[model samples]
Target chain A: MKLISVKLSPLNSKKNKLKFSVTVTLKKDVLDPQGKVVQNTLKNLGMHDLKNIRQGKFFEIEINEKDEKLAQEKVNEMCKKLLVNLIIEDYKINILK
Target chain B: MRSSVIVFPGSNCDRDIAVALQKMQFKNKMVWHKETALPKSDLIIIPGGFSYGDYLRSGAIAGKSLIIEEVVKAAKFGSLVLGICNGFQILTETGLLKGTLLRNKNLKFINKDVHIKVINNTTKFTSKYKLNQILKLNIAHNEGNFFTDNDHLKELNNDNLIAFKYSDEKGNTSNLSNPNGALDNIAGIFNDKKNILGMMPHPERMVDNLISNKDGVNLFSSLLG
Candidate 1:
């Protein structure tokens, strides 16, 4: 019965835009066959140095916030609630600016 | 039996299920994704098909659609909810069902009939069949692999909510019998309350005798029972 949580970041009191990047990838436990096929194809094409190749999705998002801490918390919440499926994917949030 | 099938824009299996339900003499109503409230029903089925073109994840977009609000409310009130294939994905995305459906292990769009063992037939969905009965059902999708963490799996086993597993003709369940490489070879699972059901197979597609195989007829019969 739990509803999807919508997390809103605090507005910048000084009207400054914040920059952050979010990367979503399949978890290590989950099998990424697409990535594996790519690796095999590369190996067949004479790329033997590659050990593994995992496919994932990445997103670069920006929001209006002044405080770095608030921005971090907000974007992290976004990844958990919507941007990523924690069941199968791992996400990383990088605060660029 | 009174039943409602929620159809999103990309849902192509709604009509098939509607016809299947009608053949069972069910009072079937097709509810749109834009609709607000669900009609009174004994059961609610979210039929398969790529909702919102399966973008941003298979069922993510359709899960946030307006009609799901009513689905959550109705499920909370104990109305039986069954989601098939893409519908199953939507259930997981909406948090109505636990775990998620990941991409198939082979990363291929598998389309064919597979045998599914009836793990537990005591519920409304499988009561018409004996426990461990094997039924043939259509499975078509690229992301039908069920995934869940260890802790969640323990809880699921404790709750006895698991409903079906991909199996062979003799009802042997193992790694080789698995069609989608689903975790634990799970093809269907029920909610903790045993009111919501989600599975990757399309039983409606096999319910008709015109198709020669009528193995799926018992499922709808159980619901109407």
Candidate 2:
């Protein structure tokens, strides 16, 4: 019988904290009355060239994960499960670190 | 009938709903949001309040509370679930009911009495009211405008899932009568099974005759029957 030896790397022991940012916005079809009010207010404040301004929410989340891809996947799951309301909102996730 | 009222961190209406339930002769219990298990309840009421201070979005955070999972399970099992005001937002956020409550068109936190017509009185929640009956109820919220995609709107209309509509005293629904810019003047709706109802109006606030009118009594009475 042949014996095999396994080696563990320092990277495996060290926990890597990944940072991600999630931006949530209402869907195009859904009306954004709050955004509309903001746009109007901005337009009145000497920003006539502005076509429109839609408001959205942003979240910075830090997760302890080793793989970048896995971290992103987990963030996406979080967005779908709690961060986003699919009925009227859409979300985009980005890796910050 | 036994009932349970969910109390979240910012759920100021918890006691109000509990009082209303007890006044209606139904044994009621106040369940905190952190509790994972529900006490075998025939009716679960998610009362109106700014849960989690309306963090992220109205009802967004509270929808993910530990107790909400059990509420969903109970609702799926054909137990009656009623969500009022912010509770309606929570229900929508949980996807128990379709659509979302957007900010008022005027971007104002409206707090006043509004008239809502009972469009369908056959459901367990509205059986005591007459079809097309008009009820004046108190509504207090910044995000009360109900919105849904066209497809879902069509389905709601086709299935007659709409439970109430903002209407005048004469039971005429129109844009003028709508306190908020809710699509089709909708004030409330039911899940496909008709066991879950989400409405923006505060029926519990209107139960006491000395404080407010007793128009909301039939709602509790209907559940008793």
Candidate 3:
């Protein structure tokens, strides 16, 4: 039983998948009209303490790589190439596991 | 002139641009988005439509389509590329043109005939129009407000790359004349090389005198010349 458990532990580490979450939001200078409308509606509904609201998109990606550094690099490439528009938006990537 | 119009999924104005191109005596072909190669053409048009149903922002999916690679290659080879309306959105997404089209300031989809003044008529796309000519064109869009960084705005102005500006009938480009709150009343702009143009108005919609006026005819004619 000790021998089998040791074998399984190596396999589990070898097949470990990396999970990442990316948050994309409009740049500081860019105007988010949709967020403004939502904030106005919330204020009208009695949420008077809300000062501002900025809308954005969130994406969760699971990469099939075992190396954490490589998985993070891949996610950054995906964000730069497709997931986020660098011109008008900024993105932050966080490792989930 | 040999022309190609890229047709992506959910493209509604593919046939409209094809008709206008054919009327202008252009040998036009409708290229599907999944195709990898573009037909041999001098002008490549990305027509207006809600590509991928405007998912993940307008034109975001369509900008990364298979055919866009070929379009980018062709543009690099100095082919004239025109992107109208949602096509304009795709161009910005692909980074072929600077700036992005944000949601309308009023947060409403505006559809109406607006006046646009020809800002620069030296390019092949606007050679037929007189300088500062006011043209009535159809604009229907929810995200037509053009925005860019301050540095790029200065570059566009300094290089005289502005193609058209929203203006009054008398050609007054003022805040009141601005339709969608575009920066500096900009309706259309050219790349630094003057080979690429992206605009929000639908010139193809105004080419027919029977259905609409002939204000857009000069644009096609200029290309033919």
Give the candidate number with the greatest lDDT.
3
Docking class of 1: medium
Which residue runs of candidate 2 sit more than 4 Å off their true CA positions? A1-15
Ranking, DockQ, top scorer first = 3, 2, 1
Each model's TM-score? 0.91, 0.93, 0.95
- Which candidate has the top score in DockQ? 3
User: Which runs of model 3 end up more than 4 angstroms from their true locations?
Assistant: A1-15
Candidate 3 structure quality by residue, lDDT tens digits, A1-97: 9999998997786567889999999998888988999999999999999999999999999888988899999999999988888889999999984
Query: Docking category for candidate 2?
Result: medium
What global local distance difference test value does model 2 have?
0.92
Question: Fraction of true contacts kept, per model?
Answer: 0.64, 0.86, 0.57
Cα deviation in Å at residue B190, candidate 2?
A: 0.6
Q: In TM-score terms, which candidate is top?
A: 3
Give a tens-digit lDDT track for model 1, residues B68-100: 999999999999999999999999999999899
